[model samples]
Target: MITAQKREESLQDVPIAVSAFSGAALERAQIENPQDIQFSIPNAVLVGNDRFTLRGIGNNAISSTADNGTQTFFNGATVALSPQDEFYDLERVEVLRGPQGTLYGRNTTGGAVNVITKRPTSQLEGFAFGQAGNFDSVKLQGAINLPMGERVRQRFAGYWLKRDGYTENLATGNGIDGREQFGVRSTTEVDLPWAVTGRLTLQYFEEDSSRARETKRLCKAIAVLGCSPNELGFDSPNTSAVIMQTLLRSPIFTGIFPPGGDIYAGAPNPQDLRKIAADYDPKTEGENFIGVLDLSKTLGSLTFTSLTSYSEGKSKASTDWDNADLPFRFLRPITYQLGPDRQVTTDRLLTIDQFTSRSRTWSQELRLVSDNDGLFNYTAGAFFFDSKGRSRFEIWHPAIEFFTRAIGLPAASQHVDNDTPYSRTKAWALFGESYFQVTDATKLTVGLRYTDEEKAIRTRSIVLAAPTPYVVAERDWQEWTGKVSLDHRLDLSFTDETLLYASVARGYKGGGLNPGNAVDPDFEPETVMAYEVGAKNQLLGRALQANLAAFYYDYTDLQLGQRIGANAVTANADAKIWGLEGEFLWRPTENWLFDSNLSYLNTEIGEFLTIDAANPAQSLTTRTPAVPVNLAGNELPYAPAFKVKIGGQYSFGVGDWTGTLRADLTWQDEFYAREFNTPNDRIDGWALADLQARLVRDDGRLELQAFVKNVTAEDNIVSSIIEDALIGSYRNVRLLEPRTFGASILVRY
Candidate 1:
């Protein structure tokens, strides 16, 4: 059973494409975080830490006012911040593919993910689980249920996790990308006098750990002039020449350059993928709090539901931007003369970047749903959401400050600081859906939604002796999105059950402000029209299950981010995507089970011309005759052409216990990380394998398991990004986690 339609229904009966995982299934797979869920789903991938893509559609821009194309919900309420520690004590997770605009509203052009937690039950029971692994990893998780009275119930759950980092810092002999976090949740349920029920939940999470290390992959000296083989032995683009020329033109450095010199003459390029050299070992910390209230009542054949939620969070991080030893000496003329008789001196500097952000969000939803027993049923709802946040970003060059002061130059030339003092989003929507049973074997469903959203932000840059003027920008967008589907059941002799369905749906993401960009302060909203056909069947007396789906999407006004000097702006583009997916489960015997999933995707960008920010010839300090690069027919980022997953499990009796053995293998094709699809942005295909063995008491009171992940020890690059010319011409690369083995035990009361 699942809630894909905002109501309880059989998974095979729903016409939409959705993948659901139960808590038991999650534990069996040893899935500890939300990112791990993607390996089991078809046509779904996770880029970086927070960027999630489904069927080649996802948000690539990093802006204060922009929203994600794929949205996440916790217990029917939208989660403004990433819930890194909420995977514990979950009832189930549902991933709905394609557009869910009618019921989910905005920011779901790619899809919607629903994370439902276990509710309070009228039972006095509890369980505890513990695990230990390599890298000094330790974890503890447990939950307790209490029956306060005949009409009251309470539940509490929490988890603690700590592990050493995987990446080694050669400069400090320390680890990076470590994990240290803890979270707790409390829920209460009460029965009201007016035939109503109410539930309240409170959750808190905190984390303090070493930040992820970014490996610097710099370009070769010859590559600075054009696209050539870089240190990674790939023809990659860089901005070395543009940055050098910009510094040369600045008045403050009139005579600091030699006849022909390279600024990145001594930059370090580490060869090991899991090792980095940096002068600074940064730390990242954050805390979040969330509260939700739900009330429901049934009157005749209709049910009324109300949900309210509020959340607040703050985070801070500091990093060594250069990823190398500082104070690199360079020869400069002291008397403003180009002759050999002039005195030469060396100057050095270090680069550091710091960021702090705080945000609060609240939302309310009221809905009415009718019973599903009748031939005609309907669902209607209204939603309101509001969020406000502030962020401060600073890039410091301490040596430049001293140099500028000695030369009597402005303080603004020494560093760059940008502060978004205020950023806000307000949105409201009205939606409705209806179902009609055309006959005993046929059904028609339709849904519609209207959304109105507005966003505003104020930015202040170069907060020094002479700070730049504050830029305030605001934009409003309205859109209409909906879905229509028809499904029919066929009575065949060989198949015990069979269903076929087709749907046409539309999705929209609101436009947003650019904060400091006055000339292009806003971007247009993005929209997608999706067409799909699918089938679900059961055979061999319900022992075999097979599902297949094919879809095509028409995407327009796709939003992308670009950097101009120290500022970022948004742009619009178009694209098309088509894919086929299949899932199968077979149980040939009572003690054996097998499953497999396959996906094939094809994506192409529509004809459009835009600036190539990574090109060495492009200027970053000023907006001039912009160089145009056509991106027609280019494949979308993270959209691998093929993906396959296969797994099997076997169970047998062991004295007074049950023993089970399971193994899984997954493979993914190569894909790019940017729209340009340059060699530097490509990530090679990789395969991973995992194995597990478990033993449980016949009464289920105790359980023990041993598991190993990434048995092949594949070193795959999960994500990468090219830095701006001003920040140095290089790429920041992030790799997948290394192989790990662990053992766990669970005890139930």
Candidate 2:
């Protein structure tokens, strides 16, 4: 039983810090999406694919309206930054962990994932699945349920996938981050007359990819001068032999150089990272549509609920802004060319772009539940949300439009910039929760919530050589948030179930309009204040189970994110984080099973202010004399200081069929990806292992499975992309995902 509390208790009597999973325990741990459940929880990191960081609080805002702090809900509406593909026919997938802001709000500070789906069942049932793997992969999934005659019911699920491309792009021979996608869902349930009940759901999904593939790490060390290193010496960094001898005495770089060579070459195994030397081919496309509505009524002691939702999404992407696909200066030199009359000296050159986005969302909720078993019990709620979005960018460069048409200008000065933005948001909330049993074994719980928010923005920035377009900005903001909690239930004998909890939470993240600053102004709202303590247990007779938690966070105004040179700004900080968490589950026998989780984190950075995208007049106490960085004690960027997850599983029987085996191990420690902890923002420390085997049949449908993941092909890295070097370090990375093996089959009726 688990709903991570919206009511459905017992997961050892829920006291927070959750991690539920069903759908056959997510297909016996071959978990398919949501970044594979971030390696089974614990400190939960995952940064590059829906961006997450629970214990360390997350949101990496590259501006698309950046706002995240761990939030993703479905059955309770709100799927904002997208990264949910319905996970098949899920019927479970909670995650909870730290701060749920009195029933999910303020993006939960760092928690909330919920996603429960699977309804409509009166009788008839169905299932189907298929799989194939190894780079050229394929998968299919299915579900069905129907029954109309008596109280109605219907369900239908879907999935389809294809994969290929694990990198290998001899420049447009294509094959870079490949995968195709498909999705469908439909659900309906009804039963009226006296007690009332109704449900409805619809979904659709689409994806196309050639997703960005990065790999080019060079951070510093390159003292200029005819930039050397091209002949398979690709540990990258160095390339200026006086801008390649003045671009080979220009004549348009000797008619594009390449026949006697020198278009600023190098890369043909420059330390092969699945090979690359791009010229122009990077991709991504996305689509989504969703809808949900639910209703209930029972009224005797009370029970009334309503939920409504709508979502829309669209995306388009392009990248290859010189991730070393050669074409000139192989590594860095956005600008070059001086002599024999080509002139376009600096201010960086060589860039390519395309980006588009769209979004729409709507939500509504209302609830009132309480059908006690005695000593008070309750839940009350109200919530509403709205969203709208639009974004566009298209940057360009081609020898700076051939040196701005040989220095005459126009032709948009080689089009170096273009932007368009618009955004809107609205929110409201009111909530409550209560429980009290006082004695029989003592019990008490309390909660509260209140939220109000608003945001609006409009922007436009265009500078193809600046002559116009740089003004058309707008901003608006408003906020208020709250939450409080306490829970206790203890009467241990050896623990047959016990819980002790404490809390104080308040979270919010809203503030917008900063399209990389057109005139600079507006980038506030980022708050948090959380403190917690927890314990949950069940022993012996219940086959051991334990959960423990401790937390502290007093983050504020932290909308941090910086890049400066290529413009990606937002700042304001004051952070402090403290953590300790643990979880364990053992079954001993009855087919045996064991689970584990652990985390320890500490992060700090107090009072930080850095929002001078090249001096927007530099006034937050001014600083930035050509790069003077200080973010106090740092350490809050992907935060990872110790993290672990262990696993186990076993089951056996032969003749009539039934067998199982599973394994898991995950580790983490060493993380930084930014927040200016320098050393080029470290990122080492990795461990991963997974394996599985299963077979079943004894008149209970059919099943078969075999799996392997990350087995030891851990390339780690998971996120980075520095960029800011008129001539040397451009840094780029994003790895992980090497070993894989698969097999699957399932059928049910």
Candidate 3:
């Protein structure tokens, strides 16, 4: 049970735009992460790559050094790595938009994504459930409590999920996408008699899915319509000279396929396009661990709480969907056939390591809560954190392969067997928040934080070409970011649940270094200033409660990922982005709820100067990409048009059985582009309806549930864009999944 005081106060009564979704709410929504089909909340748009513009402020980049748009935190521990594989053990999710530099810290010139885990409760009860659905999907989840002693207890839990891959009807008649997952969590608590409590938790999650990180194109050149080998995808050009001409205005050409096709047909198949398209091999895996400790005690007039945590994770995978057939321009063409068609038609064939990454993080935080003075309450804290990450990249090219333009032009630039080592960074900080009750029903909030950060990057690269074809690069960097907020409680005669607040804060994102020739070790930081105002209160005789907020964010020296010289290296440029975002939720009746959100943004580059003004930075115009302009002023990449949702549930009890049925409808206005710098990165808004039914025992402790998601197979692109100069990813097609049904059984002891 929660107290009136706790309910009256928010976790942060600042004016910044933010929303928190609890474990119960998440479970009821059947959502795994922001990638779910629904994109209405906070007027945000989310894509599979994890790029989200809560209010249209973030975008994904091919550059390893680019801002990830959104930074994610798990159990209060910040995770700054490949976010695609970071979802698990979430007890709640917090979406804080605009700039959060003052509190959340860097790389958040846009915003932050936070996931909080559930802690062990003092009880001997537990629940277990199993669910199965379409696509041969099955999942099981359970939680258990064990008593350790009169003053101590333990909590343990685990979950498993298995499903067939979602990809295709194989020409070879086999499942292409299959998956498996297993996870476990344990918690121990020790109650001390000295008014101090201690708790410890250990967690591990491991999964091996048959899904590869990369997707293969299904179209193959069969030559059934008298299609020339070059027309269908051969000519297999070498790229060394082609890239040189791209900016030099030389007569270097790209996009020539081999004599037979774009991809080599393997073995007896004789270098054919059909075989390459069908040769895709898909598989993926992930492993993660987390440890936590919480201790608290009341000392004289101050209540002290300490939280310590550490986490480690590793992931690796492979994809085989004919990525080798990519366009020649992107490949830097020039190649020849040393063997028959399947023997070596093009350099596009990729033996991708897919991707691999490892990370470690540790943090300690201490907080002091002022003794309640009857008229006011407040809190303060000191925090320290350290984090490290390592990753590897591999690209392949063929000597006679078409991508090298037949391999005879200047130096060979394709068929690279390359690898990049891990990059590491660390940080420490102190922060505090206090609320002063100025009057019987009026209160004010003040927050502040100071952080010191240090970062290092280590990388090793080896060239696949002749002579001395190997080189290595290494570097390091650091910075600081900080936050403040104010809140007010309304003096109402009829209803006392009310609050109005506003705030201003700074946000940051770290800089990085890449291996290309023009590698700039001195990448600058991304920063932002956030402003917000909002109202929180209950209305209509307490039958309804609402939270509304509006915010504006100004971004500066935005980090722009750029390609350098002949080596195809990378560097960070300067840009600017700014926007306005908002959200609101309302419950008008016992059986009805309504909510909505919207946002608008403007982004542009103050100056366009390639980070590497020298070296291969010859044609500034050739490199003046629309990434800054493409994404700026447009609704943030992931910010959708306005959104609204209405849901209703009716429940009744009869004899030994009670059941509740619910229906929800959600809608969104058209939103931004999915691809960058293309004329058609636009997606019209859409609406969807879903249903849920729950049957339970008279006591309501045991129950069964059924649900369906995305009832309508809306034929719409989440966002569309044309990847220029290259044939691939021309139109990233994202569609809502058709429909699926699943049921869950729950029990209480």
Of the candidates shown, which would achieve the greatest TM-score relative to the real structure?
1
Residues 451-520, candidate 1, lDDT per residue (tens digit)?
9999999987772235667788888889999999999999999999999999999999888877656577
- Give the Cα error of residue 517 in candidate 3, in Å: 4.9
Off by over 4 Å in 1: 81-83, 213-267, 326-348, 399-413, 463-466, 621-624
Worst 10 residues of 1 by lDDT: 335-344
Q: Could you tell me the lDDT of residue 739 within candidate 1?
A: 90
- lDDT by residue for model 3 (1-749), tens: 11111112353344455666666666555665466523445556666434666555564443444456577665555544234343344566777666666445556666677666656666787778777888788888888888866888888887888877554524344454466877788878888888788888777878787654433221222222111111212322222222322222222322433322323332121132212233445566778887878788878767787878888888877653223333322244334332122233343433333466777888887777776767666666777777777666443333222334433433433433234455555667676656677776566656666666665554544343332333344344445555556667776786547678777777666655554445354555666666777777666775655666766566655554433221333333344444444444555655455544455544443434333212122322245442222233333344554666666667676579877777767777665453233234455678877788888898757888898866774444454332111212122234444466788887767
**What TM-score does model 1 achieve against the real structure?**
0.92
TM-score of 2: 0.35
Give the top-scoring candidate (lDDT). 1
lDDT of 2 at 83: 74
Q: Give the TM-score ranking, best first.
A: 1, 3, 2
Q: Which is better, 1 or 3, measured by lDDT?
A: 1
Our tally of clashes for model 3 stands at 72
- What is the alpha-carbon lDDT for the whole of candidate 2? 0.70
lDDT of 1: 0.80
